[model samples]
Target: MSVGDDIPDFPATGVETIAAAARWAGEHFATVPAVVDGDLRWTFREYIDRAESIAAGLVAIGVQNGDRVGIWAPNSADFAATVLGIQLAGAALVPLNTRFTVTETGDICARASVRAVFTVDGFLGRPYADEFAAHRQERPEILADGASIITFDGTGEDSIELLIARGTDEHRREVDARVASLRPEDTGIVLFTSGTTGRPKGIRLGHGQLLRAYWQWGGILGLEASDRVLLSNPFFHAFGLLVGLLAALVRGTTVYPLAVFNSADALRIIEAERITFYPAPPTVFQTMLQDPALESTDTSSLRIAVTGATSIPPSLIRAMHDVLGIERVFSPYGLTEATGVATLTRFGDSVETIAQTAGRPVPGVEVVILRPDESQADAGEIGEICVRGYNTLVSYLDDDTPLTDERGWMHTGDLGTFDEAGNLRVTGRLKDMFIVGGFNVYPAEVEAVLSSQPGVSAVAVVGIPDERLGEVGAAFIIPKTGASVDEAELVASAGERLANYKRPRRYFFVDAFPVNASGKVLKHELVASVTAAPAAG
Candidate 1:
């Protein structure tokens, strides 16, 4: 909970946020290595200059401030610059995960009113240019079934290569002028989240919210002129877009984006670049720690290794510190609405607590625990974590309605308990709850228990609609590396510890869980795939 000062004012706009950082870096650390996009490299000044070009290009394309520009691409310098460029043009960027199927991307694109799409011709050693174009060409219901398509390189059915190529250097300058007129409260992003409402809701964040989060921790995150921040996650995520990209400017830090994450290579880059700051997700940490190269590399330069996006296992936190030699493993709890970080744990807290708790609210942020009746809950009691803060988003896109109830509090669906020390510990998602034989069972509880199993690497608990119990608990498990477990034995052990009703009725072991760019388990995707499996496949 250690913090330095009051939350500062959000730099009126997102472009201003990055521009400020570029100005600082240009003066103080011009020679320092910044971005590492595949093999392409840049200094802090060079990175900002590239963004200026893209900003101008976006403006020439008829994009206006608050206009949505959807992007579907991997983690690369182009993707990073486009985020800043879109902001610079006074436009909001809607970043879509490249990992999603065409159907998923198509649905999101349609909802956001995306005027233009930016995507790679192909990636991950797979040809997907056609998939990107199918959103405009085919019926979504029919396209959900895998359809082979071609690239939009003027073929018009497959990709946006033409659209991007069409922008000239002159266009780039015009776009920059357009970007210069943006307002702080304008929609900066339309982040899609899979909520229980059946479809993903566009979680909107304005320029003010985006800039405020970066400024709140600018000085604290050591975003000083000479520092280098490592960004390895996909650009589609707020974690990657704002914290790693936009935060670079306001906080005065240079960025080094890893297009692909290889733990061995990550160690090499840390040593080679002498990177001082990094914000990694749980999956990224898991990958690096498992690599044997960590033992041989001198990764002592990194000042902090922040982890978030999902609940990090305690073992992962300990391994990052005791094994991988990371200086700190802090977890900050936030959603798309909060502009990224709303709660943060200090760097040196014990792993057990750091891994389990989401820590205290950031300065000037107020968090409340609400009962079912909407009254505030006492400390140590389980309740919804409601937040009210300056960093909070203005509203959802196309809808200016308030997210709070009649009482004026954002009812974050996350369930948590505040300890006597006033730290927030997120337990589970409320929409994921199910009534098993008249008893309510939360998937996180069962998943945590199963994750502790010797042969289990990861597990996801879900409730399948059933005729008898109304809903039945199901689990998809990933066995530990080079290990195996019997489904019957695993189910029996779980049944022994819990009331009979809460025990999982079926178990299926899979090689991996399907996740989005943010490392969040796509529960709906898992449930859909599992539900379609005939008797657990």
Candidate 2:
């Protein structure tokens, strides 16, 4: 059935609050498993019950309505519970990336005016609490006056265990009143963008926008109770928090979150839990496929695979089906501003179609390709992709950057085109496109061509300054294990596959590319690495 005809019926869910959604999910799917972290498992009822306790605890500690509360930890059961607790306490959630440093976290926390932060003492051998305190001391304004820091894992009285112990019947009653008082239009979350490019921007989004958007996602994806999802995406990002975790609440899917992605451990969980659905960046799948344990592990239980965060390679889609045993693979595209989903490939789309395009706009979102003059571009014409919908964020917190023009159309700053079927083909970022001798060179196009090469595992193309041409493409190649490529031959292949101006002038053979917390390639860092080297004529 076409997406237009098969939309699933969802609950009226009038409140639009995360707390309300959790209550609905718990009432309906109470006995079903909601989350499984390590050996700990929580039914939907248990999950909501814990969230209520946390909410009461937060309220007892003075977290008021609309106050910003930051959660700084990796993906875990605690992370999931705190997200609901913050909202249930009538505060806006601010999820800090686990990969962020003390200074970066402080910058965002200050900008968001976070009054309280829930974090860990350390994770993966780094002391976050100590580092954050030191940074806050240095920049006294980094935290709001009298802000409280609560640790998720510690022996101190301020730990999560002690806080929950402090929750009384009176506090719980206050929590109930707080949740009831929240309006659909209330600010629900403030997610800061990854600061790979510059200082991160805090995106303020309303509960209504987030809940409505994820409902569409759950409907379009055909998610249902009993579908076990392995979420490798970090909960800090919208993809993980909104789509991965919150979507589960909407659909009642059992979610297993990996704190940090480990291919071998992921394989073990897939085998042990009989995981049916998994979604992550293409690199995560690549790493899993390359792992030696995958040959011996049982992954046939996987039914659906969702990928995005970078361009999808046609070959990888084939591998996901043939090599990884996934039945249906989907590629979706969106940014933080759009509430994490705008376009999604249909369930039964042809592999080639899914590989070639990012898919049609999800219901409610209107996508248009417009030229620089704001004129609509014809089909298959390369232009900036714009979106308008209820999913578009309200605004960037603390920055005057306009999110939309008068007509509510958000210029995505991404260059793309629509096929005859209205599927989106994102070519590259407008800021990332460079001019080579008068010709426009899109790095994504060049990278796409090179990615099909036999020995290449992953590739990133960045435009570097040239003495002759204004800018030229530099290719960074991470070759497949036990495989080798001749640079001249690879360059010759690129020459045949692309136009002269789009071809790379230099190739850097590397083990890996520098990526942000979200697994997006840091092109600026690649450019810096290329510029530090001698010019390749």
Candidate 3:
């Protein structure tokens, strides 16, 4: 039987806002560990108390309902608290990626009209607060009137602890009143997608959409109260904030957030916390599997493994089960616009199915393939992937591009097809696809073919400008430790397996890939590298 048919239906929760979800979980799972970051720990009850105080503190600082609040820090207890507190204070949250430069962060904040920003003095030796202060000096009017910065781990009178201490009984009452007054359609978060063409676009999502979507995610994963989640994804991304933090909170699972993804540190945390479920991009697994500590680390506590964002080799799934003792491995498909997940492979799916396709649509979502003329494409036909569901983004903050048509179908710029069993195989992004001399070339297809070869740890394929062929494929490969790959052998194999037009003309062996905090390879950077090379054909 096909994999998607066996998914068991689950009920969605009535929790509307992040605040409500935190409160409900606190009441039901008060004694359960909520946030475990380094030496700091908080149970669900204690976490909610701090969130309530933060909400009151935001109210005391003149952050009113519908105001935009920015959180610019790495994953920590304070990040989670500020996220929930902002929700409780009836303000939309804007999470800036820590990897972004100060100029980039300033651009986003200005577009969102952020009033008060919550940040840290520094992380990983980078002075983030200092950078923001410098930006403020350059553009004094960048922030709104009376806007301020509240440091997370900084000394001064305006720190987060001071904000909490400033919360009065009256402000606390106002926090509850504001939460009660919040409607389900109120803006929850304004996430900036790494737009391919120009500046990032703020994707506004509502409280009900994010709450129910991730509650459904907990059910999809069959998360239990006994589950301890190890989260490596950055909270600034949808995968981290929605699936990692909110899902775990709503399901009564203990969550451990890693500020920086170090393979050795990840191993230590898994052993110490007895982490059962780990949801990350495939690069995290690739790195950990290659770590020298893998053989010595006590990884038997790992039970469930979820990976995506890149093509998953069938061997990787098998290795996760056999070597890491992780029995269940799943690959979900989504983007920033779809609330981080639209389709997910279930636990019991065949290894081949999980490796080849991103399983059926989530319970409440409708996924369809549309041709260039906007007509529905038949099964097995590649076209633009479109989605219509509760999890879809509310709107783009910059331009009303009419992302959704009259019928509410949001045409994702990704190209893919579905099998008869309703499993989706994402072929490539529309922008990532380029034409050879006279044929269409999809980079994902070529990369999938190369990923299975021996000694190839990770690979990325990009189309480079070619005078003869119009555009040709160039592959950048990272070899596994103690293993070396011959460029001639790889090109020969591609010649035998892939179509002539799809074969990569050149191969570059690299030690590592330039990935973002969320483990996503920065393809544009790779393309720039190719363009700068004098010998690139």
Q: Any idea what lDDT model 3 has? A: 0.85
Q: Model 1 segments beyond 4 Å from truth?
A: 4-31, 126-180, 195-197, 218-223, 309-311, 436-438, 453-455, 464-475, 484-508, 514-519, 522-537
Q: Model 1 over residues 21-83: C-alpha lDDT tens digits?
A: 344445455666557655788775676666666655555556666667777777777677666
Q: lDDT per model, in order?
A: 0.69, 0.85, 0.85
Superposed by TM-score, candidate 2 places the C-alpha of residue 301 at a distance from the truth, in angstroms, of: 1.2
Look at candidate 3 and give me any clashing residue pairs: none
lDDT of 2 by residue, 1-537 (tens): 355325754675365777788888888999999999988999999988988888888888888888999988888888898899999999999998878778778878888899889998989999888888888889989888878788988889769988898889999998888888888778899887776667777888888888888877877777779789998898888888987998898889999989888998899999999998898888889889889999999999998887874466788899999988998888888888878778989888888778878898887788899999999999989999899988775788856576998888998889999999888988999989999999998887888788878878888888899889999888999998888977887798888999999999889999988988656789898899867765632
| Total clashing pairs for each candidate | 10, 0, 0
lDDT score for residue 134 of model 3: 90
Residues forming the 10-long window of minimal summed lDDT in candidate 2: 1-10
Worst 10 residues of 1 by lDDT: 144-153
Ranking of all predicted structures according to lDDT, beginning with the best and ending with the worst: 2, 3, 1
lDDT, residue 477, candidate 2: 91
Give candidates' CA RMSD values in order: 5.1, 1.8, 2.3
Can you tell me which runs of candidate 2 are displaced by over 4 Å?
Answer: 398-402, 535-537
